[model samples]
Target chain A: MPRSIPDQSKFAPGLTLQLDADQLHAFFPLLQKGVAVPATVGCTLKCLLCDQFSIPADYVTDRITTIFMDNRPVDDLEHTIIQDGSRVTLSAAMPGLVGATMRRGGFYAALRQGISHVSGGAAAADQHGTVRIKLFNLLLAELGPLVLARGLILEPAELADLLKSIPDRPLDSSPGTSRVLLTVRFNE
Target chain B: MDKIARIDMGAAGGPKVTVGDLGEYAGLGGRAMTSLVVAAEVHPLAHPLGAENKLVISPGMLSGTTGSMTGRLSVGCKSPLTGTIKESNAGGQAAQVLARLGYAAVILEGKPEGDDLYKIVINKDGIQVIVDNSLKLMDNYPLVAKLRQEYGDKAAYMSIGSAGERKLLAASIACTDPELRPTRHCGRGGVGAVMGAKRVKAIILDDAGMKMRPPKDPDAYRDANRKFVEGLRKHPVTGEGLPAYGTNVLTNVLNEAGGYPTNNFKSGQFADSAKLSGETQAALEISRGGSATHGCHRGCVIQCSGIYNDKDGNYVTKQPEYETVWSHGGHCGISNLDTVAKLDYIDDNIGVDTIEMGVTIGVAMDAGLAEFGDDAAAIRLMEEVAKGTPLGRVLGSGAAITGKVFGVERVPVVKDQALPAYDPRAIQGIGVTYATTTQGADHTAGYAIATNILKVGGDVDPLKTEGQIELSRNLQIATAAIDSTGMCLFIAFAIMDQPETFQALLDMLGSFHGITMTGDDVVALGKKVLSAERDFNARAGFTKHHDRLPRFFYNEPIAPHNQTFLMKDEELDEVFNW
Candidate 1:
């Protein structure tokens, strides 16, 4: 809940994303928003930072301090596998001992030997689908706006429920929101 | 500026007070001052609750100054909880006020020889040890309110509650914050038990006539203080994230890393972590007419603490930290934020350590005293502690005693102190600290999380055993030094990442004292403090075998990642070698 946010659609100012029930179902997985990331299950489990996703070179070092795949700390990102449906998470630097202990390929990796992810078996066939992504702490402020503008895969019911919870609070009233511009694009 | 106040509670005629020069304790402050006093003056093998065990209270080196985030007070004693020398520090107005009154430390020696409780008052006028039996068994909130009415709200207060009066091992010393709310606490290892043993209900400090301690070099000190404040403001952790979300922000981050220590350490991940997370808690506080960002003391620039209001938009308690949330919420399988907040208020009011109390409840649940996730049952247990019932006494003795009383074998403890929010099996560097720290399983002793997860100092692989000893060692030393300075520990994030910030802290001290200080001097001070603590523990019969996690941490593999504590005994033994 600390880092949960609806992905905003990018567009001109004063514009909002309004979609019909049928249209909402056709475009995105709105019902599973925040509850689950209904990404493609798995044809194969690939190494996270290797060939699974094309992450920028500096993203691991500069962007993300903590990484998690399938609720397990991905301290060694190059070795940790990301299956199709794996819930992947990224966050900027955090406080306390757990934060230091979870860094990817960090010097203290030896401390977590029993829990370190170890990849096994050959790579699976290439496929296109979805994977759960969560941003937290400083990463939410740094990349949230950009990710929101790019549009997020969400379940419509979750969004509706969120809006109903606090009718007075605007969707754009989070920590670092100067302006909120939204546009809904249908897949079909 | 160089005085120590000694109170002899068991004096032949009656309680008496003596003021003397600092002597051997000239340059010490905070943990260093307290630990050195306990280590030197008190007998190691004496019963912690007996007359021979003394309690030493002192402010940090930079306390009572113009420095940012430097209002922490340290309380040290032979801990009834851990049976080791303990130094617990907290942020409140007491440190600054106590220092301004021109005393380096207040040493309470010997035990009172009666059932009657007393109160001690100190001001510019003199010391007053009053036999006020009317203050018996009062809780922290009402006790402070009564004190405020009698002594005025301008005085800083430190007091005990029913839990402390009952001599419960989980009892904490309550220190009123700037707003005169008894929300800040020295909440570890039962320093309140020792205070209770001394038969003193409260120590009121009135510094109405005192001014801020003058600096030796005013201009240099001002420049250094400005640079230090600027450094904190520029850093992301201190300047933005903490101010926006407070310490509970760690709930989500730890949950994501699979090291959140849920269900009483049976699992690493909690299903309902988000409900008790910092973001949701912040929004709830804001919506309920409470603030999401506030300072515990006057000079705190980071403002990581906040105010939490209840459903009716009335003040309830300070924002619960991540450890409190995890201990009472995720670890017990309770997800309701309101429940956690209410629990926090109850703990603060009754002057109990929230972490110790919550963990005790979790252990009781494991023993079938109540079901896990039973929010009402948890609240009832805390209420019982407030009333000091027979069952409540056992519950208030902390997790180790509760686990033993209930025949629960999965007690997560080292040296009888409860392990905090982090699962050591998942984050092994913390395991090393928990196992080897002189103060038992305290997370703040050496917070490796900064490097392992936050990447502030340097990245350390949390899951591996290599470099763990060194990481815990360096952090323990650095943390000892910082705790001495009375600066908020959160500053380490910025200082570790930015070298100049670290220099600025040293420069502030140097400018204030009119001396040239180098990084080596800080390291030396840290080494001295740790050595004193280690020596105290050693004299108290602690051997290398005492420095170990419970057997279950090695035998049982936590879920999600299915990991066990992998550090070998030999490696753990080498932690304090340097």
Candidate 2:
């Protein structure tokens, strides 16, 4: 277990799940777009995160049992917000693997590019989602409908299923599409 | 009330009957008795808008008396939206005022004969059928203003708008809040249509001084109420989080948890979801010179509602909930907050259920009434409905009509009512509630909190349905019991965290009745309420099959996560095992 991950399963039994830092680092490359990566990073941007059935392997420690039965024990779950000016470093392998992977295509991919560029979360390594509501809502208002009109006939109920399969933002390939849905304004 | 008077309406031959022959204040409160009376009075298959469909208003046990947060009321009828028994509760001085005037329940039956409008006024002496020809109000905003002018400012008023007047299936009953603002509505289940059928534009209340406080061991009840409020104020969910963010806070959180439904439930997350979320809403309120937190009723400690204004500094409406945001924004692929805000604006003025309106509009877009994300076009379509155009007639009728007109196979609904914001494929427990609830796909019907953890129970992996049924059943029972007390639903958070406060409610009952009560009795009453509702739905031709998630939920997989609704039929049946 990594030093940072806390075991929270003491109260909830059968809640343990985990991802080694090495595996986490392997996953980090898939989130960054335009960064070329080794062929080992896979083709078509179809990593486990975007797959339908894969759940995050992080386990919640059973708080009740952990207190009584075992004590090599994962310490407290230390939650900290990632702030600017904090030093961030990636493993030596991330640079090459991320740089070589094939890029993701379509609207989401382009939107993520703008999001990363604006939030500047991309520079440090894994910038999943920056807190940018207005930017996101406006772009979605514009692009999402166009995508749907182009024939992604998705029903409302299907969203939760989609979310489970694809955990990260899609990479944008179309240069002028603006990629994000929220930026578009309603034409008066 | 010591007076215990009755309103005759002074005019004749309306559907008038009486109850409370069981003859005790302790027997049944507002929400419970209303459900039973509706079941007993209206034919199971009667059209919801017909004269035969009765509307009942009953006060909580403590409303007319001195008690903290006791200014609550219930509006009950066979819902035009759900096509079943529905009791939507609200907090206003109306119920307290009405109760003090001496009536346990007010049942408005049959239609009044006229194009001419009227109003019903209740006071310490009796009921008066008043001539409202002078008012002839069309809009709710101006109608409340006229009502305040006629009756004093302190009077509690219950009125409906054009949507209710037209008998729209999704119409809501508008009741005044503590601020004397007509913002806090019994905002679901077509209660307004029921009131409108009686030809009553508004019911003006003026009960001067007839207090019928529960004759509990006074010290004990007071002690219990204090503890209850204190517990509510201490919890972050009820105390701080809700008041600060309002219900819209869930926009970002639910999205992060993979529970927020987007683009007609196609994706769990909306990238720009944060923009329309509670954070942005709170920020907007600050910038626009509006209050971020506002009280719904008198003496409410957990003030989780807000009044949001527009850019022009005009009062737009309450910062509509996260459910409203998700329903209009992501469901139809329209993320423009301003456009979404327009829908909230129309819904409040129109006096209809926002959930029903959004889903219906989305369905209209699905059927080629408008292009997806053509928010302007969508607005035009709704305006057509508002103007009573032919297509507007169908859309205004509700989700079922829209689904029928469009031939859309992926209708996200249960029992004719559209499902609310939460994507059940991710939050399976809420899905069970949507499927089984008599109110038809409602989230509030079953919302029990987690036992110890700050995080709630039923946080099942979105993709798995393993524990959804069991979790939903337990929650429904808890919720029904709470609703019977006429207490605010937000109080559930405090009760979940503190056993003492929860117990004190039961203790208050014991104090009032002069008999010892147990936790088991509360459990029994909850079961009874559910059984009564089940009986109503069954009689109304609602087979167990109707209590189901839409078929597309299983066949299609949502993108991004790619999860399907995997709960089996037999597993869903287990929801009624309790």
Candidate 3:
């Protein structure tokens, strides 16, 4: 059954739904498709992943074996800075020669040197903005819940079909609200 | 595994079989055994489907032993598709069964008289060659089911479908998986045509009452095997990712990296790639009562193969691999997983190489025979091949021939063989391998994709020419060696990452063979295999000119990456330098 979570954060005009584990798990495909998350632009990937998303640093280092920022493989999380409207993809270690090539700081990094993320010096200054984040494979289970609970921004059209399937209306209709803030909590 | 069985189909009254010692071919197995035999015996200039060309089937060195992931069967011949020496391997019970039957290689030679089909059964009793014209034109799935009634499920059956019977250039020889399904195949280079030319429809290998090949140092072999399995199980790629999703797991990552060949290599990424991604495929499979993780062979620990079922929980085919998915799903502009699965089953049943058939269809689509993204047209085209219509004959000949017949300007082939899924323009390391490998544009010949895209061994920039030659060359050498040992190529990921895992592999080989196998010895074996293959190809009129990607790859810039194949011809020539 669908459960609703009380909104405690200052962020207003958002939808907060508490779903069972299975319901939340169904959203993995959406994660792979990518959802927008508000973040401080021009910060290191490590900062966005750990400090902003509140993902454990150890989990980011150990579990997420492949990271892609703007379609380029990210080898160094500490130096590669996030940009506004950038697309970030996270995945567990993949299979095949292609999978190994996408690993962070992997031995075969040179194979994808042309597509590897190159840091543009240091971030000039941090600014409030949003970046798209995508989770794939095992990472969907490991990091998906955390990101969902933290809330993500999505187009109203994108979630319309998904929300229609739910028993309860996830958010009250507000005119001119182009984006919806979706926070998913799992009811054990 | 000490004896070599030779079957001459043109024997005086009937086909005859003779067993002999390995002789000069001692200490060889898998691709090494097949390549060396083809190199030494077969006349290089002979027609691939003629009596002069031989079909050598050999198991890997460690096959039939209590080793993990050692069930690969290598079939080598002069490929009718490319007119080059070829060795294609598949994972199935055939390798383990055939090896346990006291044969290192089963050599089928000489063409039979007209209009007769034969079935050869080998077991502890002896080898029997019987006329079986009744089995003519039967596709693989039904043919195996029929054969099982007589031969029983205890044996492994290797057979070709209608495509092979017609001697189509894209034919493949099917090897039965552990479930007695002919899903695994040595699916390249027209090896099946060679078998069909010999008028042999099926080869039943029954190893009942046979014992495992004994290792010289059993205790050490066991210990090393334990460590090797541990390494594979501990590594995230082998243990978790592969077992969870199979090789189609590559679709999303490759698509995201902008190296995935879509719509006949015109684009690098497919918009509907998520629909065919491993994550989505696996979920759908489970929902339909199919398996997401399955082993093609008994000893496979990685289980990168799976079962695909229809919406109503009926079996369709084994999980379509990454290349199969891309070639049929994205390259042909069809994204539905069910369509891909249906096509995969049809390809397996018809006994054609999926890569070749799909690429041929793509080329045909480019010719205006069918519109892109037309799933019905794709199915109809494949059905035409099965029916052997006039157009089907042209399409079944593979991509290069289809391109020539239809006047499609941008055919993706090398040495007249269709390129696998990865677009060479985006992944340049694979481009070098495609242009230079003895097996035409085969990705597995030297999987630069591992390093270039997957980062399994070491990193090389996929989009640049730098380090690509060395990367391809090194991978080719290493792959040739591993293919000889009968281990699945997936082991390369774990071994390349963990030094102890590599040493464990060496130890397994050394202890089993009663010798000190080192890294240097492995390289030497690989070189020996490559040198023999290259020598055969050269004798068969293949020149450096034959070692090149289709001109379109150099001229056409694919999207997302906006890059063409960057390696110079001179740089490609350096791949075999070592």
Candidate 4:
């Protein structure tokens, strides 16, 4: 009974990115700081300007297929970075859910939820909140018994930490302080 | 040939089912009478997993209908999970066959000896107690095959997986459809484990060529059913939404609404959520070249079934749904659609509760036992559970066991079962349903169907439990009466929203019984069922104290929306008042 919502009620969570493909400079600073900019241009803005606005995970940038904000899935958003200077826009729709009818949002929405979770001290540092902290646990669910068939849970825990320790950052924000935006192209 | 009979195994003649007053309790639509049986026989407080238990499965009021989903049945008993009077409905041909042969609900009285297995098979003959050693250590998949080979697919089957065989409180009772796919289950609550405790491995029912003239008004019945189907087809929620997105359609919607429970009950969100959502599952289907929906039973107008495929479009499984996807995907922390889909395929075919298993695995992972998003491990563990290995036994034990093993105090389970998709902390109305329903923490029990059978006052705010008691009570009642009719609970969805549909149902029932009844009777029937269950629960040892949610929900705050399960205990207790 996950989505057992009552009738005529609308209380959902998501972030809709409304930006102009022509206004890259306008968004660069705010995007770099990873802050939300208010104002909507339109739902489907097919602008004729030969410009590009990159929907980064956090930091501002262009020319990336995915923007990984936390562990939210970003590859599912409709994108085509091939249209030209003509611009290829990709808004990263993210993930965060538990009950039924679970869906995906954008990078900003997932980031907002995670930061909010961490700030509220709901994840307990160790718990990682049910969102990000959960991927580690669910993956363990997929792997624990088999690992136990061979050894213990702590054995894999150490391995996960060791693997996470390998840095892939480009020295921007403090790695622990804020997650770096990844501008990854699926096939470029 | 041996006479088809039974061997009483508990207490004197094994805790006797009070068969007084009424005889021939057989074929009495498993859902309806199952409630009454639990009400009469089981002492509510007598620990759900303890000896003083009675598990009953009855067919619907009208089963065996090439009857669009009329072949459904119900399993009722005191829930070891919620410690409340409980009943779970499922789709299969067994109830139809068993009923066609004239047995209403098969009351499984007392407990069994050891883990030795037995089965109850009914055919042109009668009820036969067979030694079920052939499929003793097998999961539902292989077990179904073996049973079909022996009894033929013409016989409907109901069985449990290693999860149930292990007596996990989260275990579900699996049933086979016309397709022989054991995708349908009387899930939610540890009813299967109860059967497992009864030492029954499977229940094979074969009416073969038996004829059953269900009480129906020829033209009127047809008209009512037609209208019901039409209404289902017309509503956006039932028709387009469910069929298009299937139940997973709500994934993105639920996540957006902040009601989704990401990991256990710690948060109401997921990061890699889209990767495993209904939309994602649908995407996987399109990419992998598979179906997006199918029917749980034949002739289902709302065919929300899907063909989960491997990367190469090879047939993996069917009926990959919102619960399974969420539990394996978000709940277990895996954002991989294909991986979770594979696990769902394996679980469904094997006949396990994916949500329970996923939640259990998630809890285990939370205990630092494993990492989330491990596809190979999930597949391997699911396989082990199917194989009935010792590790599988532990895996099958579910979330409560994982919490116990890890010493995690934030276990969000009521009774002994894992909570479904909604975090009670987020949806306080559901918390009341979890806290008060006879079935422990089951959402389906009181998932109010618009305004169908019973009416409740006020619009219950999702986050608040203001009118939840009256709402839940009315739902519980209407739900019970509906189950007796052998209709899909989704039919309740129609009843809740459309008055005509509800009126049609009553009209059809009246036509069959040749009586004119008003809405007041619906209320009365619902009250009767609730009172019956309450009386049994009270006798069984359930004080007002048992009618409660777990403690951590109140103490902890779930983030994103930052709310806790804040319903007062007095409010919860008020739900049980007749």
Candidate No. with top lDDT:
3
Clashes per candidate (backbone, < 3 Å): 36, 64, 24, 70
Cα lDDT of model 1 by residue, B1-578, tens digit: 57999999988777899999999999778998999999999899989989999999999888888889899999999999999999998998999998888888999999878787889999998788888888899999999999999999899999999888889999999999989999999999999989999999999999999888888998998898998999999876788878988988888877766778887888888877777878778878987999989999999999998889988999989999988988999999999988999999989988889999988889988998889999999999888888889889999999999998989999988899999998887777789999999999999998532232223234444344557777888778778877887778888777766777777888989988889987767767778999999999999999999999999999999877788888899999987887
Error (Å) of candidate 3 at residue B171 is 0.6
Give interface RMSD (Å), model 4. Answer: 12.0
lDDT tens digits, residue span A66-141, model 2:
1000101111212212232221111100000001000112111111111111122212233222111111111222
lDDT of 4 by residue, A1-188 (tens): 01111111111211122223332222221121122111111111111101112122322222221222232322332221111111111221111112211112211122122212111111111110010111111112222221122211122333234224334422331223222121111111
**Candidate 2 Cα misplacement greater than 4 A, ranges:** A1-188, B1-26, B131-137, B212-214, B449-466, B512-517
Better of 1 and 3 by DockQ: 3
Mark the regions of model 4 whose C-alpha exceeds 4 Å error after superposition: A1-188, B1-28, B43-52, B82-84, B110-116, B349-351, B380-391, B457-465
Native contacts recovered by candidate 2, as a share? 0.00
Alpha carbon lDDT at B378, candidate 1: 91
Off by over 4 Å in 1: A1-63, A72-83, A104-126, A145-188, B448-464
As a whole number from 0 to 100, the lDDT of residue A17 in candidate 1 is 48
Model 3 chain A poorest ten-residue lDDT run: A1-10
Per-residue lDDT tens digits for candidate 3, residues B84-167, read 999999998999999999889999999888789999999998799999999999999999999999999999999999999999
- Estimate candidate 3's alpha-carbon lDDT, on a 0 to 1 scale: 0.86
TM-score for candidate 3, please give it: 0.95
What TM-score does chain A reach in every model? Answer: 0.56, 0.14, 0.86, 0.17
lDDT for residue B291 in candidate 1, whole number 0-100: 90
- TM for every model, in the order presented, reads 0.88, 0.73, 0.95, 0.72
Two-way TM-score contest, 1 vs 3, winner: 3
What's the ranking of the predictions by DockQ, best on top? 3, 1, 4, 2
